[model samples]
Structures are given as structure tokens and as C-alpha cells.
Target: MPGRDETDILHSWHRNADAWTRAVREELIESRRLITDQAIVDAVLDNRPRSVLDVGCGEGWLVRALAAHGIQAIGVDAVPALIEHAREGGGSFQVAAYDDLIAGRFSQRVEAVVCNFSLLGEASVERLLAALPSLLEADGRLIVQTVHPLIACGEHAYVDGWRMEAWTGFGAAFPAPAPWYFRTLASWIGLFATSGWQLCELREPLHPQTGRPASVIFVARR
Candidate 1:
């Protein structure tokens, strides 16, 4: 029984899956093309994990990329359309929602769990973080890449709340972007601690032209 906001996220993704898939496959997003993509890959490789779980994997690009490095990667998303596209050309992907993961629907554990620009809901993300510790092995890591709070906090008070995404620079082919929960750096640290994880490393990949961080990466261990 998630709220309207959560449901709206799914609806928007379902509506935009094709366009999103094209964008990722075609490398249309400049931030991702120039910065964030390689940042997450390097972060995951630094751990040298044999296996990885990509939660909220859209179109399964990360899963495919991980597989290229000979690492086993499983991707899961709530959107079936996205999962379907992933299955067609990406690595192992399944249709899984946060509820499914929280409910122990998948017993397989991995050395690392990576969430790249996927966590968006407030209640859903909070509950999911609380449940994620169970999906890892001893000393497993969680690597999360997100829009830098400092940059995303534009014109708004720095606090925990939901924000609308216009997908402004993501090209005109995209549908309306969904609302995402915004968390400041301190709040992000608090969330990790609340979930019984210890923050170990932080990376801020910068956009070359702007010299501004494209995304902030958090590496934590359970």
C-alpha cells in the first residue's frame, strides 16, 4: 500500500521505458556519458566483487556492463517493460519491486548491492534500506550513486523532502519525470547508519565542462 507518489513513479517509468532505454543505450545523457557511468563502474570494480545486485536497474545497462568485466550481475526493477528490454539484450534481470525484495522473495545474496540513480520514494526507500541488510553476505557493500545534494538543492531549503523532476536536460523524447525524494549529505549518512551500515568511502564525480559534481557516490559496508 504505497502512496500516490510511489505509484506515480512506476507509472511514469512504464510510460517512459522505451525512451529511457534508447537514451541509455544511445548514451544521450551528457552527465552519464561524460561522468557518472564510469564513476559507478570504477567504484564497483574497486571492491572487486565477484557478484553484484543492481536494485532498481533500469534497462539493465549496468548489469550488462558488469558482465563485461566477467562479474556476475543480477538486475531487478519494478517496471516489467524495462525488465523485458533488459532480458532481450542485457544480463539477468527480473521484475522485482521493493516489496518483493523486502519480503525475502529472493534468497540469493551478493557481495555487493549497487543502486545507481534508482532510489526515489520516501517511505519505500526507507523501508527498502532497512530490509537490504538481509540481502548481503558478511561484510557486503552497498554502492549508491545519486544526484549531488548540494547541486540538487537549488532554490530549495536543504532538507529531506520530495522534489519533482522535469527531466530538463535529458532530451525532449522523455515523458514527464517522476518525483524523487531528496536527502542532504547528513541525512544520507544518517540513513546509512540507521540501516546498520558504516560509511567507508565517498566519491563525487565531476562534470568536466562545468567542473561540478555530476553525482555523489556513497560506499557503505554491512
Candidate 2:
């Protein structure tokens, strides 16, 4: 199977845009519906940010959610279709790539920058992280939620590498997934340090029924 790469991943998102929009809106994925979604929301809320920049905000779900808490949120994504869908749902959204995220001038620094299961590409994620300090307030936080390394590793080797994602349980509309890179726990911490971030906290939300972690949340500071 081919591994996760930039070209293939973006192409997959473009191809799967419609299906993904429906899936997110309808809560089709069991993990997101049961655990990861609320997990990320709660993590962001914990910081009590007045303004948040949601990186890779697909369909603007998180942006709308944060608005209910009176937090101003701006969502940006590389996919035009996803950004369009997000805007239709009512919130601030922009079409931007990883490079755009690093270079685009915002009106002001935000209190929190959240990446919810979206930092999958290796180089892009690293570069984006390095540039985030400049976009945040003095006490700002960078919140990242990703697949639990142990769980996501499945039967694969326990190292940093790209893997083919299977869009299981998302139904026939999604036969495959975009590129996803797996990072070990140590690797995650190292990435943060090298990207000019200090690891503040790590959270793993569990599946209530099985007690298995649904995803790992990393809260960091510059």
C-alpha cells in the first residue's frame, strides 16, 4: 500500500469532500461521534481562549461550536470545497494551505490554535508548528488532537512513518482515507520541542464502553 504523501492526501480530500461533509455533519464516524469531537472541544474550552484559530477546520464544525462559547474563531483549510461548506454553515473561514497558514497575515493573534486530527503530513505539519508561535498571544496555546499512537499503530511498525488510511465505518461513500502519518509518543514530544513549543499537557480521551483511548490530545505553549 502507498504511504501518506502531500499530493495523494490533498487529492483524496478533494475527491472525498462531499462525502466527508455529509459524514461530519451527520456524525457518521463512530470515533469522532463518541469521543474525539467532544474531547477536542473540551480541551479547547479548558484553555478559556477568547479567540481561536482552527487550523484545517473542515466544514467549520469546531468554529460554530466555539462561537456558542462566545469565542471568535477563524477556520482555514487547503480544500476549497471544505472551506465553502464551512462558510455556508456560518462562521469565518478562509481557503489556505500549510504555507499560507505560515505566511498569511491575520488581524490579530489568537489565544489558541487548534489542529483537530488534521496535522498528518510530516513536513507541512512541522513547518506550520514552527510558525505558530508568531500567530499566538503571549499566553497562547497550541492544541493538537491526533490518533492515539498505540491504537493507530495497529499491527504496523512502531516508528514514524506514513500509512494507508482505511475509512472504515464511514460507509461506502468513503472507501479510502487521506494520507496519515503515525508518530510514536516520544516522536510527538520531540516534534513539539523542535518546533519551538513546550509540551504542557497530554490527554487521551477514552471510549467509555471499552476504556480504550479514542485519541491523544497535546496541549503546548511557545
Candidate 3:
């Protein structure tokens, strides 16, 4: 069972699904417009995988993008509403939580598994890494895009811990704020190594105009 913090994080997404979908699709956020979305897509395409699994895929944007390139992509998310939206967007998607994926609920191992700004906590990272061996084919790759830990740390001291999303600029549409655990860059490297994943490439997606890193992309091999 998820602890209080995990529960809150899940609930926040469930409640704010619609708003998030709109924000992402409409490009209301600067990060998506400048770096996040395209960066993730580029990383996936560079791998040239025949099939990809999009874990925690929200509204299936990445899946749709991948399909445009003629790549087979499957999306899975915990929120039923988001899954429904993803289907409406014309992509294959299923309602599955992180735990469900870890349990091999959705069969068919893929050449690549991509988590786009979806990994939220240390426990989740550990659990997902534990399940990768079974879900990935031989020589499979894992790609992850997340808020740059340095940017996420912001004014706070550099450390690993839980940080509540301010939800600033999102307006009153968001009813609840989402909380994500902050992992330092070093912590991330160590975590992946201990989980039996070899760090292959670490790239920062820079804003087109400002040249500031908006997200960190990690490519690992099993």
C-alpha cells in the first residue's frame, strides 16, 4: 500500500488530470514548449527502438508522437481518466499503476521503456528498476526525463527529500498540489548503479532561448 505522501501524489494527478492535459496539449507551460516534450521524443527516436513502453504516460502525447514516426508505442498510466483521454488521442493505452507494471500485469517486454517526467519518488525508482529486467528485452534501454535536480532544488539547500510543488502559474484550476521527492544528481547516479543499471548517457535539455536546462534525461542499459 502507498503511504500518505504517495497517496496524496496520486490523488493530485487524478484530480488535476483534465487541467494537466489542457496545459500540455495547449503548450501553456514554457518548459514543454522549450525543452521537455521534444527532448523526450528525440531521446526515444535516437534509440530507434522497434517498440517502446511509455510508463506513466499522461494523455498519451508521447505515444502519439512515437506513432507518427511509425514506431509501435504503448502507454500506461494509473489514472483511468487519463487513459481514456489517451485512447481518444488514438494511441494504445492501459490503466496501470507502477506496481501493476512491476508485477508484469501488462505483458510483452519492449525494446525500450521511457518514463517522461513521471518518476516521483525514491521508492518508485527502486520498484521500477527492480521490474525492468523482466519487462525489457535483451540489450533493452531505459530512458527517463525529469526535472533537473539542480533546478528543482531552487532556493532550497541541495539535498534529497520531499518537496511540494508550488503549482504557481497553474491558476485555481488545480485543486491539490502534487508533491515529488527531490533526488540530487549524484543520488540519481548512485541509485541507478545500485539497481543494476549502467548509466550510458546523461543529457540536459536546454531552453531554446535562455539556454537553461529544463529537464535532465538519463539513458541506461540493462
Candidate 4:
């Protein structure tokens, strides 16, 4: 069963779906424009995957982007509103949560599974990692981009724990802020190993203006 934080995180996304879709679509925020978006896209393209599964694909921007490149991509998110928005953009999308995926709700195995800044809690992540083996083709890869533990820590200490998003730039439009677990760089590597994933590559995306690391992208294989 999902814990309190996990449950809240899920609910918060549903509540914030409309606001988030607008923010991401109209603004194309600085971090996304400069770093995360292209980084994830480049990582996927580098693998030349024919089919891709985009987990927690909020608003399906990546799915549409991949489609524009002639790559077939299916996006899944927990919020129906987000999925609806994605469909409106002509992208294939499904309303499914991480638990749904683990329960084998989605049976198609793709060449790549992309989690774009979506893996949140340790328990949920562990379950998702364990389920990946059955969800990917033999030689498929998992591409994950997430908030860098260092940057996410902000003034907080460098440790494995839970952190809440300030949702600062998002303003009052977003009512429920989501909290996510923080795992150190070493912790991330260890989690992959214990979960039966081989960490193939790690990249740190930097803020174009400040030249400071913004997020970390991990490419792994089962």
C-alpha cells in the first residue's frame, strides 16, 4: 500500500494537473529549456529506440517531442487531466500510476522506458525498478532524469531523506505542493545495484546561465 507521503504526492499531481500543464506548455521553464528537456530527449535519441514508454509523463511533452522525431512513444501518468491534455496534443497517453505498471497493467515491452524527473519515493522507486525487468525488451534501457540530490537539498544537508517542493515559481495557482524523497549520489548508485539494474551512464545537466548543476540523468539497464 502507498504510504501517506506517496498518497499525497499522487493526489497533489491530480489537483495541480491543470496548472502544471499550463506552466510547462506556455512557459517552457528555464531549467527545462536549458537542461532537462533536451538532455532527456538526446539521451533517448542516442539509443535510437524504436518504441519508448514514458512513465509519469506529465502533459506528455516528451511524448509529442518524440513523435515529432518519428519515434513511437506512449506516455502514462496518474492524472487523467494530464493525460487528456496530452491526447489533445495528439500524443498517445494513458492514465496509470506506478502501482498500475507494477501490477502488469501495461504489457507492452518497449526499447526504452523514460522517467523524466518522476521517480519520487524510495519504496515506490524500488518497486518500479523491480518491475522494469518484465516491462522492457531484453536489451532495453531505462532513462531517468531527476532533481539532483545536491541541488534539491538546497540549504539542507547532503543525506537521504524527504524534501518538499517550495513550488516557488509556480505561484498560488498550484494548491498542493508535492514532497519527494532525496537520495544521495552514492545512494542512487546503490539502489540501482540492489534493484538489479546496471547503471550505465550518469550525466549532470547544468543551468545554462549559472553553469551550476540542475539535475542528474541516469541511463540504466536491467
Name the best candidate (by TM-score): 1
1-222, model 3: which lDDT tens digit per residue?
Answer: 224457677888999899888877787888887678899999999999999999999999999999999999999999998998889889899999988988888789999999998998668768888787688889899999998988879899998888888678654367778888889999999988998999999999888887788899999999
Q: Report the C-alpha lDDT of model 2 over 49-150, residue by residue, as the tens digit.
A: 999999889899999999999999999999999999998999999988888768855556899999998898888888889998888999999999999999
Per-residue accuracy of model 4 over 92-171 as CA lDDT, tens digit each: 89999989999999999999999998998778989998898888999999999988877778888898887787578653
TM-score (all chains, Cα) for each model: 0.96, 0.95, 0.95, 0.95
Question: What alpha-carbon RMSD in Å does predicted model 2 have with respect to the real structure?
Answer: 1.6
Local lDDT at 103 for model 4: 98
At residue 216, candidate 4 shows an lDDT of 94
lDDT-better candidate, 2 vs 3 = 2
Residue-level lDDT of model 1, residues 28-122, one tens digit each, is 89999999999999999999999999999999989999999999999999999999999989479999999999999988999999999998888
RMSD of each: 1.9, 1.6, 2.0, 2.0
Native-referenced Cα lDDT, model 3:
0.88
Instruction: List candidate 3 stretches off by more than 4 Å.
Output: 1-4, 170-172
Candidate 1 residue-wise lDDT at 161:
84
